[model samples]
Target chain A: MHGLVNRAIQSFVTDTYGPDRWRRVTEAAELGDFEFEAMLIYDDAVTEALLAAFCADLGRSRGEVLEDLGTYLVSHPSVEALRRLLRFGGDSYVDFLHSLDDLNDRARLAVPDLHLPALDLREEGAGRYTLACGPGMPGFGWVMMGILRAMADDYGALVLLEHHGPHADEGADDEADEVIAVTLIESAFAAGRAFDLGARAG
Target chain B: MIAEDTLAGILARLCPMHLLVDDSGVIRRVGPTLQKLRPETPMPGQRFLDLFDLTRPRKVGCFADLLTGEGKLGVAFRDAPHTALKGQIVPLPGGAVIDLSFGISLIDAVRDYALTSADFAATSLAIELLYLVEAKSAVMGEYGQLSRRLQTARISAEEQAFTDTLTGLKNRRAMDHVLTRKAASGMPYSVMHIDLDFFKQVNDSLGHAAGDHVLQQVARILVEETRQEDTVARVGGDEFVIVFDNLTDRPRLRRIAERLIDRLQQPMLFQGRPCAISASIGIAPSVEQPLVSPAGLLRLADLALYDAKHAGRSTLRFATPRPAEPAWTRPAAGKDGETAPPSAVSGRDS
Candidate 1:
């Protein structure tokens, strides 16, 4: 894995939880020094061990930790460039959802060595879309769900999202894919304007 | 909204400063944020390359070249000194848009650009890398200090181990080391054994402090009278030894011993009283007996010292090979104040 991934986990734990908590997690992981270089490559086990230790430190499941990391990716000041890149995807929430298929290519422009999972988006109906995530990254679907939620907020769109289990026949295979169904409820900006009008009238 | 208005809004929101230029290098547009930051530069018609200097991709000649280059480019504004920016150029319909973000040191970026934790992202690991380097530097500094202290302590311990505390001269251990090394080399050398004649009387009448004062004075005289190459050591109470390298001649050895005794006989003030002391010296020349070991040389000098004391105090004696006779026999003093019968003063026979 690239050092960027490890550093993100470090930033997430240090910024969200605190440096002390990060230190404890690293200690439990048996890592004497946890400073990672941005362009360097590290063993995949290092990231796995850190995630496991972080989960143990916070007493949370791996999915929950990944989801938190996803949210932190968009909101944390340190990753503002990534947020900007994500925001550059499109002008509207629906357009951004369609742009998910090109995320790997866009990410490669910044980090050539990055190997993100493939994404497939399908328009289900009016104000609805279905997203399929390829295999190889465990618990990454939850992180993506969190990012989608934050992206919806950024677009001023209220949304409803759901995750479905892998197909029964595909479950026996080593590479089982997961799916997420997204539905836009309403425009949050319009709702805010309505509230403003009500306040003025009162 | 018009397409241009949307583009301008995006640029103003995302970048602190930006530039839009045509293919002919004419400035087509300047972001409002940049206009606000640098109000002095002519915005609409000025050449973009004229105001900003390209610091990266050394071969780039024009703004169009920058648009086609790989990765980000570093640029500094001519009007705004010491401020740098890093950004990429995106090709547009007729020209290109240069999207720029503040390019500064990590510390300066946080202070001046208002960069927060979100800016660091997962891809930025510079802070943690710098922290590790600093920790290593601190550890190395502490280790260097510790090493220097240890070296100083070792030198002090070595000095104390081989020096006499009272007279500030080399002690018995230092003399023994020099003698052993010289003896093993089998080089022609000489040893002078000096015993203070009336040191005990000084201690008995004037107190040990007065005796110590006299010893200090005698030590000073010994150091002054002897050559720099000679090793003078206080081996015991009221007893001293001197080693001379390559000075085995009998007459010169006797002269040095006589001069040392005369210097010691000088009056030294101790507690408002003048105290007189003399030395009985015995000289053993290694050239006379090439086979003598360090221990054997010391014993021979001691035997000669006994002869000097018997002949009378404040005198010098030279050691010769011992005669074939009982080792306990004492030689009688002659009328000339020398031990009778040269063969009777033999050191090896004794």
Candidate 2:
């Protein structure tokens, strides 16, 4: 089945590009269930949430949308259709997704060892991009996927891509046992320092 | 390998659609959820930076961005170019930089009306809370900037208001304000005037540059000899005044003047080289037997200073002779010579 998917994708790319396109599209897949991919793409409701969090960063909202370009989510096609399927119900999902980006960014940045670069305009490209990775066990891939897809529909013209899969695995699984469930309040505060505590480094 | 259960849970929650290589700037994968969003663009595992400029550290290539639909959180991108907020970086314990971000969403009428009754009830509350927070954040940011600006202004005004830039002594206005405030409290006050002898000749011979050096050193000497509480002013090109308030006795004033003459007599070190500097000092007591206004006290000190210049350069004179006289002027006798008469010591007006 994996071979079949790869062949189908390669054939489609070949037909689409008379081998002239600089690159070809082929499936780099794992021996996982079809639904496994689906599950990986849209499954955040199961894990004991590391932190129940909500954040509202004002500066990014009015003045700028995102300050970190490195971790910024660039959404495209597949993301939009899923959003519609998830019953987002019109623009309500738009606002809800935007709010989520604020929340997600807050948490990612607060991680003890990550200082992602800022999202810059002088540096942003015409295409959108997002890093989607899941460390084999207890991966953040789903969360990354959630952000990427929601982002896709949010902008019709912009193209955001998430980098995910086995290769992208951060390999953080066996290192830690229990997942930490932070109070939604904690994640909000943790992430919203961009908003809370008002202007200080780190 | 990401945890199956956890990844499943988060994926169920997020429904993320795209992924990019952390390094090498490649499109590592794209989940099925993303494919449905856009019917076209086979974006799976495509090199993102391959087609555009991702190499430059801080530049914008997009004007508008967005992420929409359900299972999809309400994420909206802006139309403005992405200007990386460099200073907005928030650092985590291990050198992690947390950049600033916020999301804005479009309002849909159906969705607006479809919220659960409970969720609906909280709708206004949530929006109000959000607005309150937004307003608060704006105010806080502005407040921080304003605080910094005000502190800088205070320092600048203070610098201009209190001390002389060149000599670092109390300026005339500052001295007057302090002394006047003290004088109003009925406190005792005394004034001393020190003027360089033949200062004009020094300026004429060595140039104003050397004269400035001479003045700076004299200011240092005067400041060094006086009490911290006293006021000193370089009121004129070659004239300086010192006011000592709340002193108890005559011996103290005499001792201070003696010290002034003895120390001022030492050769001045101007601009890293030796130069000569000499002064005539006048002292007037601000005692109760015959009180004088600040201006009048200064005038008396000036007269006594004139006598010192006549006695000899580098001399000290006290206002003991012709006490209570409206115009106090008399020659100071150098211990090495006899006192000169009033006419002998009188100098021609410059």
Candidate 3:
């Protein structure tokens, strides 16, 4: 099962940029920070404005953009801008967040076989949640939900971290992280079709 | 008119019923009469522990799990009708299962059938040999799954062993591995040592649980501050060391430290109560001074950390590896935009 997951990840990487680029990325990861080539690109307000133009260019709704945290805008400028930041910001934290955001959008526009929908979040209490959802299309919705969760978790941790001391805002983030993790696991189950293994992946 | 005594002789050749299972515990088939007696739901997934209603599963095949199509998972039972049942299911290469008389009493049962004791034992032994051959093949079928489980367990154990049990964060063992690698890698890396300020007060005022929650919360923050490539380990009860690899720039490092301090300053809400938590961090820049060894790097980082503690909690201090070289600083906000440090590659290199 772990091998299956790894295969899925490898396939995703290969499909996105080809095997050569993936090999380079893995090499970079293994080499750590110093020996690797600088990969972050810079973008100030003007670049951000150019990137923002994509929102209107793509004819996206405010709800769509806001709800998805700017996942909808994927013009050449937006991707180029992100590529720049991903290369130079030197913040892998920010880069990962961008990668996940792109991944979310990538599934919608690029991956034709994928059939998953956005998730709904309901606040059960001050810090509780209820994902009022059913088993998705062969659990495709579930998989998307999980990927969303993993992105949030991995980046959220990277973004709001302290070197030492009493870590703050943990309670709020813990709720968020758990929701994300659960979504990922649910998606994994759905993707694996453990619920109904006999059915073909639609 | 015939009494039809020959009909009984022919009927006795075949057992009237049989119950069978695949080696993996899926209920494959039941004898014709019991087909409808079996539940409609699948018995493939249910583990042996949860399989049956009987207190313990006998090694023998008399037990059965009763589940329905509508229910989640369930169990049921039928009386074991003892017989020397034999059947063939060849598509499943392995020997077909016999639900009766494979137990220790098979020889005795055969003797009761009017066969001599030696004949019963000898013939039954051949059947047992066939079963053994089938059992060995089943074990082979399961080898891959077993190996994967063991590999997963080994990785999990390695991580657990290197973790601080209290906060579920990397511990000293992880630090040792990182420190060892830092010496070998020849890459410029920074060690930022951090110590919590006034943690004892929390333990004194609230309770150990409160202290623990604070530690857990901090673990969350430390993970956030470092790169996925970096190691964040709790080397002491209240001390942590972050190995920042791939030098971006000093300002970048400073920015991270500042962010860490600012985040920690905010009041922490733990277990329904708001508590104040603060820490002092010492930064040991790898490039500035040539480290004699990994131990020297640790000492320098420690010195920086101690300096921050002396400066007061919620503080950040940096130690340049070399005190003599002031030539290598990057112009963070330079006038001409000639970023002095090669570290500043003009933005967006991807």
Candidate 4:
């Protein structure tokens, strides 16, 4: 994983929790100093240990933690540049969903060594989409679901997201290949209006 | 459905600022955010390269050059002199879109652009790294201070241990160390063993406080008469030893001892009462026998001192080599019942 990915997790913990909490998590992980550089490469075991420690400290499952990280990446102002990059994909909610398939290519332009899991999007009905993620990342499908929900809020589209276990059909061999189904209940652009009105009232 | 203008407004809000440039590097469109960042409104026909200078991606020369480049580049706008912006330039069909975000120092960016922590990406770890460096520096500074204090205390303790409390001269222990060192060097040297003529009389008549005053004054006289390289130490009550190094000439050594005796004979006030005291000095020259140990040298000097005391006091004597006789043997009395000089007594004993 790129340093950017680890940094995002660190920021997710610090911003949502506090620096003290992050310190305790690192201590529980038996990591010393926990110094990280933006462009430096680190062992994959370090990230795994930190995540495991975080899961234990927070008493949450790994999937839930990753989902929270995904939500934080979009909502936090610290990741405003990344949110802008993701928003540049398209104008509408469905356009953004389709652009997910080429996200890794776009990300590679910024970081040459970045290797994100491949995503496949297919339109099933008028307002429904089927998304499949590659097996390269485990338990990351939940993070993708969180990102989709946040993107839906950004686009002012009401969506119903569901996760069916990897083998929805008899032909599926491994759990690494899983598909998520998304249904759009309303595209009224009402959420953005409410947010803007709240901002104005404040 | 969202209108095109509304979507563009949303995009502009997400970006720091953006500029649309033609193939000729002329500004074609300016986002509303860009208008707010600049002091003057940008004209559509103006050249984009003339308005902003590229700072990062050092290889990129102009706006046209950035169209062929990858990754983000830093830019400094002439209109906003103090602020630096960073982002990417994406090539379009006939032109390029330059998207800029503030890229100055974090402290300055926060203050100047009114940006909050939310404006920064969580991927940036430079802030936390700087904090750790500062914390480590503070700890090192504290440790350095403590080390310096400990060194000062050790030096003070060593000085106190080797100094005489009353006379402010080197004590017996310090003299022992110096004599041992000099003896090991096998250099020609001389030792003067001095005893006050009537130190006990001053203490019995005027009390020990006046005795202490006289002793301090005597120490000052001895230090003043001797050369800087000599070592003056208080070895016992009313007894002092001076070690003069690297001197072998007898006439010069005798002159120094005579001057010390003359100075001690001068009258000095002790508690507002005139008091007079003299010193009996014994010289032990090491020119002929430089290999003598410190203890052997002290015993020879003491024998010479006994000779000086028997010669009716307030006089000086030099130790002569006596191969067959021990230093502790006392000189014999004169035929008339008075103690004879060292040479006369040695002759009588032989």
Model 4 CAPRI quality:
incorrect
Q: Sort candidate 1 into its docking category.
A: incorrect
Q: For residues B217-249, write the lDDT of model 3, one tens digit per residue.
A: 888898987789888889987888888887637
DockQ of candidate 3 against the true complex: 0.01
Q: For each candidate, what's the DockQ? A: 0.02, 0.01, 0.01, 0.02
Docking class of 2: incorrect
Question: On residues B212-235, what C-alpha lDDT tens digit does candidate 2 reach at each position?
Answer: 877787789888988888888877
lDDT accuracy of residue B255 in candidate 3: 88
What is the C-alpha local distance difference test score of candidate 1?
0.71
**CA shift of A4, model 3, Å:** 35
TM-score of each: 0.38, 0.34, 0.31, 0.38
Ranking by DockQ: 4, 1, 2, 3
* Native contacts matched by each model: 0.00, 0.00, 0.00, 0.00
Decoy 3 TM-score against native:
0.31
| Tens-place lDDT digits, model 4, residues B1-350 | 65544645654555536776787789776665455555365546888767777677777555677777684778776665556778788877777777776543534544454433233333343333322333344334435665776699788886768778899888888999998898788877888899988878888988898889989999998899888988999988899999988876778878988988898888778868977788888888776445556667776787788778768678998877655324343344543544443454454221
